[model samples]
Target: MNWRLIGACTLAFASVQFSPALGQTDIQSQRVQFARGASSATVKGTIKGYAIRDYVVGARAGQTMTVKLTTPNTANYFNVTPAGSDTAIFVGSTSGNSFRGTLPVSGDYTIRVYLMRSAARRNETANYALAIGVTGRPAAVAPKPSVDAVVPGTQFHAVTSIPCKAAPGQPTRQCKAGVIRSPGGEATVRITLPGGSERNIYFNNGNASSSDARTPKFSVTRDGDTSIVTVGAGERYEIPDMLVTGG
Candidate 1:
């Protein structure tokens, strides 16, 4: 008479034992390779349920590494962990969607993409694209000559300095200074003030210019043999020769 109730209880016990929530599944990581002299790589995938994906890449120290993540789901993020360490080197949620900085150690790094804990429990799906770029170490640079000690026969070129009017109600004034040089060799521009402060900017392409939002505002532009520089308010500058020679 109790056979039907006993059978129901046995079926319920078997279902609990074979349930997916009560067991763990091992997920394997994928390896990523970069081409020679290549600075960037991208990985794309979809994440569903409690599954996670990982990518491993090798990098060198002193290299500038940058990462960017694009995803439709806000609850999906990634983690970057250095070799032999459990602590994440970079976490997407805490550090934002992009990371840019110099790497300290040379080794394989892991990039893990997964959903947030709540999202994982709900078995949500997320599609994402991850991009990484590594800029190799810069070439070895020779030290510059001392500022006080001048090299013999090194002539100083005269530059035209134009006073720049400050904005209305502004206290300090600025200037647009110009220097003429021969169109060859690497161009080095040095700005020296009366208080012994100096700022050096180098142009490898021989003729180039750059400007940023930093203040005191400054910019450099090279056209043929003439180099024009814009300096901040009330600062003096020294424009040396286009050719910089030293050990």
Candidate 2:
């Protein structure tokens, strides 16, 4: 188990006296080993809370990669990122749980699996089976999806930004984040930090928690229509009910 902290003071915040260690998630990585005369492999694992699992496989730049994730929990999704880059080529949360794409500049591609903040905060567990395959010769050109077409796995009901402070001692600014809600009104808030990493916060049954690996220590303050979330000692976020609940 190779465990690495996601990042410290993320969510585009720079810490002063107190660090934003809300969802300090730890990543557990495993390398995929293919049998002789085989190009595909299947692995099974279980994750609870804010734990993350990553599967790494080596492939040439032009090889095709196919990944399918089967899990009972709707909150569990995967992401594909090329080696040496933080930007994900495929985000399963938005693109669906299956990915078939041609590799670009790949040495080792990582497929990361995680639970949505809403479920992770409740100490939920997700058991999943991941099937990964690499095959096909390098093609002259990769297939591209048509623009303006309604793509599959587009999960957001609404997308917007909220007022936030970048860090302690910083002025209030509009920090963009993504919100997705289940039919039961539980919402997960995802914020992309600098360098493409993401921080997620969950609002479930009127309780709030972040996806950081560490146990969360924070406070919330209500003002008018906005609820201010303060993480650690000083990092603060102003979340409006309309943005979260469609009120």
Candidate 3:
């Protein structure tokens, strides 16, 4: 790492301390925490070449948060950096399966993960898992309808009502990924935009993915004091707009 990058990392860790979401208890409490003294935030991941790095401290506009890999590996030599504002903070290089990057954009960013081949383990493939946190408390939960049964307007500030009998046979029902309920499940919802950029929203916390496979991708391009989401699956009672109040 260069002097400028090293200085940034030092300043970031030295100046800010992250906060864990309170009352947001989940199942993966054991896999989280640094050493008890670091903080009580708990985010868990069970993927290769990656894991939830750390909960950033004092995450705000114009701030840079660095996430580190838990272990180092040689098979995977590097990482991916997002484009545009997303690229401002990113996975720069390979440091023993660990990395140093900043959070440039806010409202749920991602670390594009990949793997490299190893000389000894010639067929080595990576299946990484990761998590996120901030220096400040997680955003408060907004009371949203568990299931909306109505059509909504383009600017969806109001919750659309999903009638119990909206579907033809009334045989299907929707499912929700409660923030504090499950902390180990994974959801891979891909949403493509007009700009040719796709957003891969992963919703895990145990309740994220269901056996029925009814989950949605949540993303915001701009304009919002609130976090809005929409489910992608065609389940009758599927709800994608979940509240992120807990870790």
Candidate 4:
């Protein structure tokens, strides 16, 4: 993570309306081009004081998009907005220098890079490199696993038990794993079963004293040292380093 200090520029602001159907605006913005499949573009540009540079690209819902910014000075940040909407879908600032996620809607997405509002008053100018990439098919939901299976020769220490539902026509069971907590308010756990693949489980709030019925359940198995985890379709989990081992 890069801590880029940004201040707003002093340029006069303009009110612009975007067409919802085309997701386009009359405002001057740079159009970015990419080849089919996985592609990336790096644009070198400067943001004058109180001014913003907008870059637009087309994307489909479910595709993964990543954007990164490198600035000559710390006074720049970037935002990503979905087509036809003024609200930013993603924002990268001093706390983070990049953004990555699956787009929720298909259309033209805009990436705007500029100085912070405070810096705008001074008309600060900074050079920056903005890199953007979009790839992969539209995200699809994953089917539920048939049964809770454990891989052979793999062992996981019990962390806590949580309620989980089985696939349709399958039996339900209480899930358990070897869990590790993160400072960022999440937990990573490893689970194993006999003759099944290894899996890692991620959830919010590892500090739960007891399992909540609302917590989404995942199935896991083990394959030697690797854990194979499966979740419901359209679900996502952040993968973190395993810090603990279960017996």
**Can you write out model 4's per-residue Cα lDDT over 1-247, one digit (the tens) per residue?**
1112111221111112221211222235999997555488888888766667889988764467899999876768887876534546466653366888655444688988777655665666888889999876542221111122212111111233333333344444444344433334443343333233223444443322111113355544554433344465322222222322221
Report the error of model 4 at residue 102, Å.
0.8
The per-residue C-alpha lDDT of model 3 at residue 203 equals 39
The C-alpha local distance difference test score for the whole of candidate 3 amounts to 0.28
Q: What TM-score would candidate 1 get against the native?
A: 0.46
**Which tens-of-lDDT digit does each residue in 93-140 have in candidate 2?**
777899986554336788999987878888789999999999965322
Give all candidates' CA lDDT scores: 0.49, 0.63, 0.28, 0.49
- Quantify how close model 4 is to the true structure by its C-alpha RMSD in Å: 17.6
lDDT of 3 at 155: 10
Clashing pairs in 1: none
How displaced is residue 94 in candidate 4, in Å?
A: 6.3
Clashing pairs in 2: 23-211, 23-212, 24-212, 24-213, 25-213
All candidates in order of lDDT, best leading: 2, 4, 1, 3
Which digits, one per residue and each the tens of the lDDT, describe model 3 over residues 45-70? 43232222222232322223345444
Cα TM-score of candidate 3: 0.26
